[model samples]
Target: MLLISTQNITVKLKYYFNNNGQHYFQRSIPRALQRFYGDKKIVRHKLPSIHSQMLLEMNRLAHHYDQHFKALKSGQGGTPSQIQEQAVALLASHGVLPGAANTPARVPEGMYEYPHLDYIEDYLRDKKQAGTMTKVDELAQLLLSKPMPILLSQATDVYFENHEHGTSEKFKKNTLKRWKNIYDVTGGDIALADVTREMARRYIKHRLTTVKTTTVERELKTIRAVINSVIKEKSLNLSNKFERLTIPKKGKDSVARKPFSQDEYRKLIAGCVSKADEIRVLILICCLTGVRPSEAAGLRREDVYLDDEYPHFDVVEYGGRTLKTKNSVRKVPLIPAAAKVLAQYLETHTDSVVFPRYCDGNEVLGDNVSGATNRYIASLGISKTLYSARHTVKTLLDQAGTPEYLAESIGGWGKPSISRGYGDGHSLARKYAALQKALTTVLVNESE
Candidate 1:
């Protein structure tokens, strides 16, 4: 072992030999000795290059010299080589260099370079377009890597065509935020193809147990949709990535809930009357017309055809925004009971909206009505949702012997299997006539 330090001499070194690579110094080596016996000086004498093996040896020698000088300064009696070896062991233990105590890093057997990102990018891009998901990591990576305007263009497409207005904006923003979270978790540096099914599976697990199943499903669906859109646009040449991405089957695990019954419905409407009369009327509208709460909230006073031979209301204006579905803009014949509520509700309210404002003075958006309706349902001792009112109307129609096709039409449902054309005035009139005939015993004649 060698002990070197700097002193008056330009270059100086004091060496002591020991059987083992242990060393101690009897006196303090001056600073001049360190210059002569520096790391470069040692390398010059031992090896020409500071190769990996040489670096390890140099580190050992440096540590040993330091220890020897320290021990001698403290009056410890030991050979230079003995002290050096002790320091070498300590340095190795602390992972200063490759040694017996240090585990060698394993070289990856996989590919040296990242594979093609095009297939994955294209797949995720298509899915985002088809309404599969938003803020998808897979889709985002494609944009970031290629510097394409696909993300912005895709969002614009959805905004203009699919998601628009108030609640849709909320939905889009929320769904995109979830996609961002996935990117953050995945480090956002991986290619799409490398994003294996296992990666998606882990993401799903995190979403389901850590956050919410709804959130997971929304984000996953958005991502899948973006990939689908990319495929449709011919941006991706590979087969569906969704085919490879294994999302947990969520259908069986989701709980099915029942709608409110007639008596329960009455109780809920009554409870919400005091809390929010507007909400009460909206719920009743959903109950009578089989419209969704969002649809009912979107109703306008002008949409009510009070002068019709048989007075009814059209569901035209939606959420002070847009309609639920193209078919949802149909007219529902108002039973005398529903008409009575409408007349009474219109007496004081003068806004264009039918069920306009929430109790909190907020405009009736989908979310606003949902909370009010759910709370109203809960207050009535019914463990049902506000959406249950739509079901209740459907049940009532079924009990009244209305055919399923007519029920779907009257409810303004957009079932693709059904006729997509606007209904003839005569057909609606005939149905209402039949309904009037069926309820002749119970319904009072307004024309009389």
Candidate 2:
């Protein structure tokens, strides 16, 4: 078969042939045609495409002709078949299949590439929606997968929207400051996976023995929160490290908790001078009502109900800075003596506050009444922090045959444990009133 084309003085032609059982090609046909016409432009334009197709056809024909030649030579008993067999035998001896050798080697496509972070972020987001886990748990899980900076950023975002966020601005500031401090100490650059158990153990050691245990524990809890959140939100794999991290048990003498004894209370009240009368009255009100200093400070004249079946003060105003917990909000019943003290204190002032001077009926007393109260307690040769009043209430409830659960409830202790017997509900005044009543009962019995 032959193909030819010409334009002006150029000519292009393809010649194909079969000879016996073989295919042959002659290259001189295109040169012969170009000489016959001399049109080089047409020859140049079609040369590349024509040459490529002819080469492919020639290669295919050579392959077919070689197969036929091999068969014929094999029957003729030549060395060609023997050489071919020997070649195949060598390949097979080397554990290579001759049939497969020509089938073309297949190269498996490279594996799918993936980003390491996408797995971690997805796990954290999934964990966040599951409500059962604590925020600390979620955070710990997140931190375990993500880097510290990412975890820290997430924690900061969550902290601003938490129950603690709405508390006193000081509380928020202090918490943020603590986080920054931890970040500085930890280098703030490592991934959660890189933070090994050994590092955690060392950090815990530093917190318990050198630094304040509470401070370290608080920061630890925050970090734990980050991990837990990640696991909760993203389904990230993580171990619960907080389970192994033990916070120190507070020593009895360390926390500055002292409940006033009967004699100490009497001496404290007696030591109030003319100028310190308001503080004295405040102490008395605290002792009798068993209200916290902050709760007491926020008390208003109108908040007291003298006409109810039981005269009591409604602790509606939390510390001007905080509402604290739900237990802090309740009506605290006052005994007749405490009620009388409150009435007398209110008579001296015509403002909203039951004890107006502390706030000028505007601001509430914060958690720092210790300075004034401590001075007054010291003047009487008695030494005690005003918080001792709260403990005093717990001790009094125990001594007066009040049921533990009732006492705990009155003190706002949801569940009274064997260790920390009473709750934080005004433990001072309740205990003081109970002690005074017991003393009076003892004196009456002795007189009889």
Candidate 3:
């Protein structure tokens, strides 16, 4: 015996059935919805002796249709006639229509159902066989919500604020400039999710027409970095489209910068009108210590430790200033020529900075000095820039047979190697010894 009732409502029914010597029972809807189903008799199935599973399934279908019919009656879904037509069609599709054949009617094209339990179980099993598809779909949707231009703009600002582990005004300006170029080239409004490899290749091709391979490569790397930072910060599951791009090798389409010969360097120094001039001192420091013009210009009074037995200056990031790499943060040993020039300048220098003229409130210490120095060298019939001094220093070190490690330590060239990672690299004593040997062989007349 099976007893079913719409709880405390106008509809109630008593049914009797047997399956495997046991009785079956069911209800069309829950107690909360009994008022909605009041006096509406459920359509009954008169098949062979009903089994428990079949009765349970029939109850589920009845409840599902009852809810739809309630919605239509309340004017929420459609007019009563239309709702009745849909209800009949649904019942017919499921082989539940009155006097319908045992087989289900063919569903119309372009219509589908939320999978029932049996179909749902099969779908899940197949999904397990297709790995990561669900996750990829989710990530793709998320990435589409945010455009690439917005991500690039925000990332560029953050990078400038914290470049080289600190703020660099010069680098900020340069990066912003590059970002503008990217915007101009790529039609800035394009969505990041829509950016394709073909677009990136077109941009690179455009850049190569007006710039050297190295310059194009650098710009591409900057673009890649900006996109990567955004992806990491937002935890996006997509790969960086700009990464792994093919770039020309160094010196592929451009001539390498030349180092000044000893004769040319000597003649260039002799042309400086006054030995007391800051440019003269700066040039000498670069030639001897191989420090960048910017580093020399940014030098502070406290950076110089000339009073120690082995005089050196600290090259490190301080507030607005920044080193190029971790290996660039080192104590540069002052060779004899460099120490003499610095000593002379320190005697009369009263400001906290070694070079005050170039310190224009901004931390960029070398642009003016380098410009003047380059013009001075060019006027003296030397076709070399101020950076040629650093190249000259490396050349002299190599000529003197200084070991590669010691040369790299002095010049801050190349990445830090495993062996160099051990302790504070070669001591000042050994570095100074190499410096002495290199400077002696290619000694410049300081008195000039």
Candidate 4:
């Protein structure tokens, strides 16, 4: 018999021979002592010989149960019932109790459990005695409510499904694609808390080798948006890990997009006259109205109001088209060239879409239209893209001395001043006049 003394309690281990000369081990506590475990004779069979390994294993098991019982006695463990059940489980696992082989271990309830929660509880109890538990409880609740080790992938899915509502299908698709690419780079299964600024910088560095800095910045922006949305919706106290990552700005070494000069614009217009009428009109609309190619291509017949006094088209968000910004939702005044193109288009057009060749069910119309436009421009010995038309419009507006506010209004660009909020904005008549003056000046210069 060996007596092991724990916290004010003694456990007796005895070795004996069974009827068939098989050795066995048994553990017991005094029946009169009801403190640690209620009076019971804990016994087990198939004992190892009294060797160093066997004695070491027995000592480890005794120390493990002793710590558990100490926690229970000191009110550090959970409820009495929980402690009792766990103690029985611990003893059974080490074969210190009879029928230990048949006992099943307890399964935790929630999907995630943390050992730090025990330490947190102990700290709370100490703080409560010191009358400083108020602020501590707040911090404790934040930890307690937070899901342990939330994955960036999981949070991103939840954010899009529940939080990101009313977004256009095109925008959603692009955003999701960017997110998937980011997940692949950043490790989808990585804990959100584990994503450091250094990791983000490394990701940007890796991407910069193959993609533009702007593209990497956009991906990081999406990551930041997803993390922010999840934190806000779930009321998580965690900070956004991607917020502080530094993104490089476009430098002198960057290949800047070349905007069309006056002569280049005229050459493009002249060259495209023999092309498809839809393509010609699409290019004209982009130049004259400054609406994005996607916005113009996704335009429906109802969006065009050529008969109105202003003769403008609505750049509204519908179908699968998405505006770049809320300010992109404005009435774009059709210049004479654009109006002439629209009239010609409406004469033979039967489809609802203004540009049927480019649109294909939730696909980004701009990408398809721009690809074709770029190819056509390349054939003309010029390197201008379809978006060069927008830069041309801006240049024309500047030359025509169009006021900043009116020019922004005409281009459906975001307002640059807080004062813009105080008024109803430039009237359609004012916008049309500004655009006419600019387009007429450019056209006359081209003709000269």
By lDDT, who's the top model here?
Answer: 4
Window of ten residues with lowest summed lDDT in model 2: 38-47
The alpha-carbon deviation from the true structure for residue 264 of candidate 3, after best TM-score superposition, in angstroms, is: 1.1
Give stretches of model 2 more than 4 Å off: 1-154, 162-164, 167-170, 177-184, 188-199, 210-219, 226-244, 248-256, 272-278, 307-309, 316-328, 347-367, 415-448
Local error of candidate 3 at residue 162 (angstroms) = 8.0
Which candidate, 1 or 3, would have the higher TM-score against the true structure?
3
Q: Give the whole-model CA lDDT for all candidates, comma-separated.
A: 0.53, 0.52, 0.62, 0.65
Per-residue lDDT of model 4, residues 33-144, tens digit only: 2343324455343545655556666666566556654444455434333344344433342343423223343448853343323434454477688877542243333334
Global Cα lDDT for candidate 2 = 0.52
Runs with alpha carbons beyond 4 Å of true place in candidate 1: 1-168, 177-197, 210-218, 227-250, 269-276, 317-326, 358-364, 414-422, 430-448
Off by over 4 Å in 3: 1-155, 158-168, 234-239, 248-251, 360-362, 415-426, 441-448
Per-residue CA lDDT of model 3 for 1-448, tens digit only, reads: 4433455744333443445554433333334333333333333333334445655655665665566555544544333333343434333222233223223334676644322222323433465677543432222223322322333445675555445632666666666666666665556644455567777777777777788888877787778777776666656666777777776564478876799987887776555424657777777777778888888888888888997778889887776776677788777888766787688877886888887887643475556887887887888788889898888888888988988887887778865455753246446767788887887745645544
Query: What's the C-alpha lDDT at position 379 in model 4?
Result: 85
- Each candidate's TM vs. the true structure? 0.52, 0.49, 0.60, 0.60
- lDDT per residue for candidate 2 within 1-448, as digits (tens), equals 4434356444333435434424345332122222212222121111123546756765554454345334434443223233333332222222222233223333446733323223333544665676554333333343343432224434455545554443556555655666565444456644344456666666666666656666677777766665565555545566645445766563422565777877776555444322335777778667655567766766777778876556777766434345456666656666655565566666776776666656545445453465776776777777677778777777766777866655654555555453543444554355434544533421222222
Stretches of candidate 4 off by over 4 Å are 1-153, 165-168, 183-194, 232-238, 248-256, 360-364, 416-426, 441-448
Per-residue accuracy of model 1 over 1-448 as CA lDDT, tens digit each: 3333356534233333222434322223444333222212221113213235544555556666576445535533233323333333222222232132223333467643322333334544666787674332332343333332333224324433533342455455545665565554454534343445556667777677665465566677776665465555645454444444444675546665566655675565555444446767777667656677776776677778776778887766433355657777676787665677677878877776676564212234567778877786666677888776676666666677866667677776645233533456566675565444433332233343
